[model samples]
Structure formats: structure tokens, C-alpha cells
Target chain A: MSAKPIPGTPVFTGAYAMRGYALNKMCYSLNAAANRAAFLADEDGYCAQYGLTPPQRAAIAARNVAQLIEAGGNVYYLAKFAGIFGLNVQDLGAQQTGVSVDEFKAKLKAHAIHNDAVKAGRLANV
Target chain B: MSNIIGSVATSHIPAIGNAIHKGLQKDEYWQPFFDGFPPARAWLHAAKPDVAVVVYNDHGLNFFLDKMPTFAVGAAPVYTSEDEGWGIPTVPPVRGAPELSWAIIEQAVADEFDVTTCQEMLVDHACTVPLQLMWPEGWEGIRIVPIAINTVQHPLPSAKRCLAFGQSIGRAIRAFAQTLNVVVISTGGLSHQLEGERAGFLNPEFDDLCLNALINKPELLTRYSAHEIVELAGSQGAEILNWIVGRGILGGAAREVVRNYHIPISNTAAALQVLEPA
Candidate 1:
């Protein structure tokens, strides 16, 4: 599904598609130690087999499955959990969320020109 | 049926405070965003939860890539905000319930939930920072038990599994046999576009619906698969595990106190909610 927008915000066009609430809930009870271990061992593979993308897969591979399942419940938790495993979730996105750090600084530099009067001895804290 | 005293749903969108502090929220373009939270704060003040079990996703602050605990519980007495790169100014450390946390941990383990126990932690902005804003400092003698999730990573638990964990937590909390009033707090979102070219995006309509499902009808959300939430909320949205924790622990039905949402706070849309036993 395409992403929706807030009343005034424009639709953003980019490679990364807008997200939707489209997950299937899984039963999380473990009947045996073997089952738990198997789930842990194949957690990454399970997500991959089920169609989790690469960045998502990387996030799941990084954490202790037992702790993650208990604390975080799904993909959102896994994505954050991936951070613990050292995968940069932000960088995983193909689209850019905002201006780069350098870009931000350059914008500030350009904006600085508009307020030159305040920069002089005219404004106290400028 | 166990008495679910209260529950809360909050957004741990790390950038909210940053936007507020920088006067970005006050900017004309951002004014609508700041306006969304006043009602949220008012609602929380009325609910007045005694102790809160906050479930949220950590941003690689406490646990690292070397060894990450999928579901780690905080049994510490005090949880201080950590210096995650650009650190915040000095804020008093939040208090925690080591006893209750340990009790829940022990019970969850016995109940067959393998829970990780954390002693010392630098509670990142994703958790403690947001709590500071939503709930009052001294009211109802707030004590916390931090539970961190691995949401940003893949191979994470599915949505159904998360709701199941929340159910288990509800059972565990019910068996506590303590007289203290407990509130389950879940932090994270509906559909927020964080990161990438789609940053600064917000869907007020989706946010409203998510709050509705969480408060009056969580079952509505069950239809959504884990992948669906990620696609809608953002990849980082895996942090919504906190919501599942609330669903599990709160049990039965709830009275939602707050549902405030806003967007364009440093490339992330943010929302906050509070729930009470119906």
C-alpha cells in the first residue's frame, strides 16, 4: 500500500515505499527446550524464509533471541534489536529521511547570510 | 480475570525533546506538532499511575552488537539517562523497582519465559527520556522496571508472538499478589515515516486509529502482521514491541487517556498515549 499523508504534508516520492500495518501475529509459547533452542538458532533464517529483507535479517541475527522475544514482540523490536547486534538500521533504508549532516551545516551557512545585521555588534547574543 | 489497574502507550521518538529544546516545535511549520501533546499530558495527569512497567526498544545504547538480549528486564534501583552521542543536560536519575522487576523476572522464567536480568544500565532517551515528559516526576511515587527490545534488527519476534508475551506478562503481574497499583506502559507508534527521503512525514488519521485499537480494540491490530507494522510505521518501528507488552500485561479492556500525535520532528513522527483499566 502507498503511504498516506497528514492533511498538509505533501506525498514524498522515493525508492523506499510507505509502510503499512500488514504483519501476521505468531504464537510465542514454547513447549520444550529444544523448540526454544531451535527457534533461537534459526531466528534469522525464519525471518528470511518468511520474507524479512536483508537489513531486517541483520537486526535479528545480532541479538539474544530469548531476551528480544520477551521484551520486544515483532519487527519493530527486531529492528532495534538489530542495533544491539551492530547493524545500522537507519543506513539500511534506501531513502534519505532528511538532509545529510554536511547539508544541514551548509544550509545553516546560507541562512547565516540573511541575518548578517544580527551577527554584528547590533545583536547581543547573535 | 486479573485486575489490570492501568496501562499507557507512549512514543519514544528520540527527536521530540530535541525539537522542543531547539525551538523547532514553536516554529510556524512545527506549531501543529507541538499542539498535539497538550491534551496527552492532561490525560496522563488524570490517570495517575502508581508504578509503571515501561516496555521500549533501546537504540544500541545499553546492549551492543556483540551480545544483545532480545528481552532484558531492568532490576536496577536507579535508571540514569545515558550519553548516546549528543547527550542531554543533567537530569535526575529515575527510580526503578528492583524487587518487583526481580519478582516478575523470576516468575516469567518459571512460567517458561527466558528473561534477561540487567543490573546497571544507562537508560537511553528512547525510554527514560520520554517517560520524564509524559508522566509527572513525583506523583503516585513512580517506580519503573525497564524492558528493552531488539526492534530495529531483523529475525525479530513476530507480532503474534509479541502479543503472547504481553499476555504472559499480564499473568505474571497478576500473580504478584502485591497491593501496589501497577500500570503497563507501551511506547511506540502507529504509522510514522522516520528516516530516508520520507522523513518529516506524519499520518494523523493512522495515528488516531492505532490509538483506538490499543485502547478499545487491540484485536483490530492483530490482523496486522509484523512486516505490515514495519512498512507502515518505519523500520525502526520494531520498537512497538512496547505496545505488545502493554497488551499482554494489561489484560481485558482499557480506558485510553491520551492519544496525541505530531510529525516533522527531525525526520520522525511521534505520538503518546495512556491507558487505564476499563
Candidate 2:
């Protein structure tokens, strides 16, 4: 609600919701198995059917989370797009973090170990 | 009069469902996780509530981004599980307590909560995963009243509001004249972010704080803003809102009967807690 936003995170506010409506709707369509196949067969045509903006279409083509976010794509909906490419949420997270999937996974494992050590009082600050 | 018996909160990770479906409960990788659920299973069997009011959020399943409902309740007689894009082995349809569902809807609306009532709804991992973990025997004779909350997109309901919604649901259940016991189960989150540059983030410290607060100091948790939750826990950690709802259903205070927290369950920290009215 404030002019000072939450820094880096793209808050999916009313404005973002409105801007990404078409893009989100397209992503939503991937819930159905048939819809996923259809999109894979004709990506551009599917985007067009959803009335996606050029930027959104470009973002879809690029498979970039940042671009999709800028084009008003919510991460939850964007997950469907990622799934179509055999990328799970973690894969998408890796892309968003500018790291390779293996690196991202390793970080997760390290974080868990670090947290466990901290809980056991072996480590102080994590 | 119908009574609110108890509540259970657990992380409904999709991987948990897959592991269970693949019969990997005894496997080394999943053995530790499965070890935590025996107490929960025993408790469920002992309590034997006639109906369970399950609070879970759909992940692009029933309601897509086209029209995401902040709060949706299923009033259908039977609810089936969705395929969730990839082919998840289909489970038997869970029977729904439509009469109780309608009663909750009517009372919730009167309580000034805008709730979407669905005649037909599909349950996804959010609902099925937890069900699989909590009640592995399956949902053949068991009855469930599914309440879907929104934690997918931002601008989600505040922790305080979600708690209030749970309280309202408790009241509605009490108002019903059914001579049956009820259990409230809320699924999702300990701490894991699925999006942004801060992906794969986990905070056991914050999660412990949350589990403690839910048992002894739930009022303390309501102060946490969505931004603070994301900053401390992770984006998907917002699903803790569902847990808050579970706590609120028990009203003032409840004793934590069971608590389990395990980390790195597919890029997220998974937790399970059961509370009984004190």
C-alpha cells in the first residue's frame, strides 16, 4: 500500500493482477492436459488466443521469469508454463536466482544442514 | 450440537504424495518423513471424527488465475482428485458432507466473509497429499468438507483474517444440530520459497518460532505481515496462513499433541502438528 515497495519482490497487487490477467489466464489454461498439448503444438497461436501482449508473448518465447513478471505473469501461473518445459518450481526458482539447477539444489541442501546445526547449537549464525 | 473436536496442520508437498504412491514409505530417502506420521495416524484412528473440515489451497487446479477465489467451500456430495498436469494415479472420490458445507457457507456469509460456494470441485495435491499422509487407509467411508483458501497470488488474506475465518467456521459447526464430531485439518508450509532470486530459502528458526507460537502464542503470529513472512520464511511459506486457520478453529488455546519438522523436502521445509482442545 505504500510507495516504498518491498524492494525486489514483485508484489502481485491489483495493478499487477490487471496487467498480467491475460498472461495468468494463459498459464491457468495449462491445468488441463489437452490445453498443455495444444500450447506445445502452437505456442504463438495459443498466446494470441489468450490476447497476450507482445511483451508477454516475447517473455513466453524467451522462458524468462523476470520478463514474464514484468509482463504481469504471476509465479504461480507461470509455473504451468515452466511445467510445460519439464521445469518444476525449483527449476524456476533456480532461473529466478540466476543460478544453475544443481547449484540451487545444493544451496537448499546446505541450508537444511546449516539450519539443523544451528538448532543443535553447533552453529551460531546461519 | 456438532462440536469442533481438534485440528491438524501439515505441509502438503506434492513429492510426499508421489513417494507414498510409489510405495517408498519404507525406503531410506522417505523413511524419516514417514516415521513422523505414525503418531498422527494413531491419533486420527483414536479420535475417529465423523467429518474432517480440510482447509487447503488449490495449485492451479480447480480455480485458475482466471478467477482465483480468496475463500471457496465445496458443497458437492463427492469430490474427485485432479491429475495435476502429469499423470498422478487417480484416487477414489472423497465423500463430502454437503449439509455441513452449506451450513458453514450460510454462517460464513452471515459472518461477513465472502466465500465462493462450489457445486463441483476437484481436489489437488494440496488436499490429497495431506490426506494421503494423515489417513493412508484412503477416503472411502470418511467424510470431508473441503475449504480452499488463496495463497497462490499475492495480496492474500492476512493471518488475522484467516484466523477469524477459521473461528467463524468453528461457530458454524457448533450452530449445526448434527450429533457428530468434527476435525479441522489445515495443510501447507513450514518455510520454503518457490519464486524469485531468494529461491530455496528455508528458516528453521522462524519455523520453530511459528510452531511454538501456534501452540502457546498464536496471537503473536497475527502481527507478521505478508512481506515479513516472505522475507523471513519464503514466498510459498505464505501457506502458513492455512495453519493459522487451523489453530483458530480450536478457539482460545490448545495443547500441541504432535509436532514434526523436517527440512529440504523438495526445496521446502515440511512440518506437521496436531492440537487438541485443552
Candidate with maximal lDDT:
2
> Once model 1 is optimally superposed onto the true structure by TM-score, how far is the C-alpha of residue B80 displaced, in angstroms?
1.5
In candidate 1, clashing pairs total 52
Candidate 2 residue spans exceeding 4 A from truth: A114-126
RMSD of 2: 2.7
Question: B59-93, model 1: which lDDT tens digit per residue?
Answer: 64576433657678899988887444332333467
| Candidate 1 chain A: 10-residue stretch with minimal lDDT | A20-29
What is the lDDT for A116 in model 1? 26
lDDT of 2 by residue, B88-166 (tens): 5557788999999999999999999999999999998888888888778876757999999888766788888988998
lDDT of 2 by residue, A9-100 (tens): 66677788899999988888887889999998998888899999999999999999888988888877887788777778778878888989
Who wins the DockQ comparison?
2
In model 2, how well does chain A match by TM-score?
0.85
**Residues A61-106 of candidate 1: C-alpha lDDT, one tens digit per residue:** 5543322232223323234433333433233222133455445333
Model 1 lDDT at residue A46: 46
